[model samples]
Target: MSESDLQDNNPLDPGDNSNLASGEGHSEDAPPFVPGLDGDPGSDQEEANNLEESTPVESDAFNAHVFEGQFEPNITSYQIIWQGSPNYWAGRGGNKIVAICDHIMQGSMESANSWFKNAASEVSAHFGVARDGRIYQWVRVENGAWTNGIMNRPDTSLPWLAEAIQKKINPNLLTIGIEHEGLTGQVFPEAQYQATLWLHRNLIQNYGIQPDRQHIIGHYQIDAVNRPGCPGTGFPWQRLLTDLGATQPKTTTLTSSSSSGGFLTGPVPGVVSGAFGPGTVNTNNAYVRSYPSFGAGVMVLRKLPAGTLLKFIAYTDQGAVYKGNSRWYLIDFTDKGGWIHSLMIS
Candidate 1:
């Protein structure tokens, strides 16, 4: 399906969401959760900070797209500044991103900048969207951040904990945490809301995640006794799904064989395919575009030849279809090495 097709699907429509207890994570759409334990987050705050040993961060001066990193932002449009934090696990241990958990800072962005940076704070969300709309990525999405699981090991087998207990993994391993500024009594900022909408859309799209409460959840869902009002009151839970259903991007797949006519030139001396791995290119040359889709106006990053050696870091299947393949691998050559279509490699 094309980008338009994704937008046309009402997958996230609030009307279609029914709160059915499926046990399996995101097997079906669920309705908005009504807050049950809304009170002072005082004790939970202490418990959360007391248990896990930490993780946010600072931004650089340069606004360059060509970054010095191993992974690139899935949502490329926003002004996302990489604020490296030290309090996170190295990787997800092969676990895919299953949920995007929303959280409330309950404090100012400046406080988050200081606390998330402090190792003693022992808490860090993957991404933080400020009230002013500045997006900060404290931890890479591929890693297990000390966001929700930093709290005391949840020993309770409450019905709400069905997903994590059943999966037999730390909640952090299965979810991406997003901390939004403000709390229950305050009105959620529209600017922050818009920024989060795009962030959620891009994040869920990358994993083909269902845009529902089961996947796009609040922190309260993880540990209700502690953070029952997380991402707090006034947050537009239903509207988030409705808006995403209408505006999410759709990657259309076109079936054809060897339609990469533009890549017919001879192989270059040291260029090759490494999006998925060191798979030698079978074609003459493959174009590394800035993003996934191939189009007239898309920016081509490199023209790699068949003989060039290659290696890869990660991949995403959300890319546009080419020769019946929608898979693209992320090469670690540089932040701008971009993506190579899977078919280009042998």
Candidate 2:
């Protein structure tokens, strides 16, 4: 669908968003989760230090993208500077920026489309217009997009996480930037929150990046040399790290798997055509989603590319029903549950 279609269907509408800031989205959407003790910042600090020390060595596998012009050249004019020895990649006085305009998702679907489109086109970053926990990707993660910037030189101590970023930024290249739907202060719905965390976890595991608070920074924390308070303080930074199992900062490499596997299986890959239905037969496709109506606690055990294998995690009556047939397979990935065509699975 085009960007307009996505905006028209923005999930931020009151009717679409039922879980605002309740931390119901992903297990990690909740805020201010104290992992150890309220005062034990030492352990956290040590962990952070260790992660930094163990930071992964940069690679040249990623391709960097050409950074577009400023977000609002005339309107935004901020300056950033760094402190301490030039050896460290840390800076001070920079904060995130928030747009006074209505939340990206609360406005017209067209607005959502434009916002994401503009973000992707105007800036070098991975942008998505997410609603009700569903996210639409506007940019690929393979290329280094200009999403993060240093207000000053010292905000970062290490060089780009990889060669792509090194040429452009000291660290932005290594980071996977994401934009969520909602106003600056508005709380994201539980479904959306869960989706964010799930997606984050998937990215972390897929990319093998260490899951940590340091690596996962909110837009608010970013400063444009002088501009500040972006993305607003409302972002649940702590909660996101906890839920995604990314607490340690400075970790360079992640050791986990992010693949969710296939939802449908067929004799050939990508052959599971048609919309999801009850007993419609599933062909191996990893993109299947289970309708949330079936409730939770359902899982799938299959691989992608069709003609692979089969296994069921937890069965539920949620998908593809025949003319009057009453058989469903519970499907739940990234949180928003849904049904699929049975015949599509095979």
Candidate 3:
């Protein structure tokens, strides 16, 4: 496949390259791989034997099989079906696979495999997860797949990410893409979620990646404008992050006396109380709900005008993402404490 084809066949957008641009202030040169522990020298061979033994005599619901082909770096314990088109290049010079990006196939596994395996598609990912939890490997972990398109512009919300984009380096060079079999907004099956969790854990352990949102990000976060709804908002981000032990502390103590009056007489049931911190409303007429989620049958206490300063006590994860914000903070408004969406506050 041609480079243009590879650049044009992103699953999120087939022909949008407005975000593609040459990076600045950094060499286009890839990094060098720093060899690390490969975990139990005999593990791969043993696993290969086990995999062969575990192969079913007949096809069943989980008709999983390994593709016994050569890997780019030739270092993976999992079964990989070589279905990648010859459109990718060697990964970041260091043979490094830093991030694990998730994507929705927007179709069944068959269609995903068909599209990625076809040379004309020019799009491919390192791994694919079927609805039945079957895992397929298309590209080698050490190679770059034309999965995540170039980020032509820097994401100001994540300044730390600018370095990678500024180098104009393809994220495929540093990340492994896992295409989950499904359509946008569809909840991932339990089997698929389990399989992905296993894959992610293995990848994290193998690559020494910090199990955090920064390292394991959804495609939507990477190219928010171009692919805002990718992997869908229904994706259980909190569950995945919690499983990876990446959740951060939500409580912060305040020293100012302005919040003392708002403190409740006793700890509220099901509510995590803490000292208040200063925050400002960023949106007009933001509602302060009695609960984190609007679906929780909680009452909307009041509305705070934009630019209203508030004291936040704690935060909760209600799996609600309003205007790109998933967190809700417990704040004091009108002398009554309520939960406010993070998007409405700076």
Candidate 4:
């Protein structure tokens, strides 16, 4: 997917060539076989994933421009799905395009090997989809990259949503929206949820976003005004909040019973009774990872601050803990280790 698709009004106008980075700067120049996803080991996707969405004032109005560094060499390849037309979300005359990527594949070969190279010929990169839950960005967050039009016509307004418009639902500037391929049906893949939380939390920290959660709204919540049942009813809303470390009213108390291998119990009460029984399996997909040192540590990450309380969602014998929507944290209890606090289990 080309970055040019995101421009409504280019603030830099550095010419088409400028935005297109050459071999030294952009990772697209690298061959499909790279070691890490972010192009470099130690190049934390969180650190290099700095997206600068500039809202420079011009002509008494705000002009938005999305400035981003090149993709990491580890991001082997990308499939541009649509380019000319908008996706299913953009009403009818929207300018948005969608792209799907295989981010966590092995050397040169996509783990799924299912490539839709021709997809971009039909749409733009207004939205991106990843097999994992992570959403690496390519566009700004303010302009209507073309998801939906504010003005349907000169006369007779199409009842354009005032709140949505005010929120700048433009696929161009206002959002860096992402769709997870594995999030089909009511359940999302364990890998997707964990990766998504890290991607989002990093984005929040990198951009210094206020309220943190405000910048990251789900596709379901976006069309809440006009469309109903968007993003589906089963979309993990609470998980998203917890993944981003955003605060919300407690819906249900997630408890970690000493039985059941000390796994975090589900919403139901007394079903498992926290017993470590036959069905209990130690897997990484069971919980969220809460890193205290931000982004450095063991197979999981780092430790949380002392006395920092975390809500527990589930557990995995894979040495990880899941706390929030997509928040999967590694469980550690060493001198350099950390602890995870649960809402139900103190």
The C-alpha lDDT values of all candidates are 0.54, 0.33, 0.55, 0.28
Residue 43 in candidate 4 has what lDDT?
28
Question: Which residue ranges in model 2 land beyond 4 Å of their true spot?
Answer: 1-112, 115-121, 149-154, 157-171, 224-227, 248-346
Question: Candidate 1 overall Cα lDDT vs. reference?
Answer: 0.54
> What would the per-residue lDDT of candidate 3 be over residues 1-346, giving only the tens digit for each residue?
1222111222222233222221111111122222342321114443243223222212122122321232224222334444444334443455466678887766677766666554444566778888787877765566666677645222323333555666645566778888887766678888888878767766776667677766787775565544444576667677887887775445343333333233322222233355544666655567776555555355666677767887766555443554333556677544567667654554
What TM-score does model 4 achieve against the real structure? Answer: 0.32
- Best TM-score among the predictions, by candidate number: 3
lDDT of 4 by residue, 195-288 (tens): 5554444334444543223344433223221111223334455677765567653333324433222333332221211211111112112222
**Cα error, candidate 3, residue 154 (Å):** 5.6
Per-residue accuracy of model 1 over 60-166 as CA lDDT, tens digit each: 32222212332224543566766655555656656667778887776666667566655554567788888888887766676667777422223222233455566
Model 3 residue 140 CA deviation (Å) reads 0.4
The predictions' CA RMSDs to the true structure, in order, are: 18.4, 20.1, 12.6, 21.2
Q: How many residue pairs clash in each candidate?
A: 8, 64, 5, 45
TM-score of each: 0.48, 0.36, 0.55, 0.32
What TM-score, to 2 decimals, does candidate 3 have?
Answer: 0.55
- Model 3 stretches with alpha carbons more than 4 Å out: 1-80, 152-160, 247-346
Model 2, range 173-199, lDDT digits (tens) per residue?
Answer: 345556566654556667666656655
Which ten contiguous residues of candidate 1 have the minimum total lDDT? Answer: 14-23
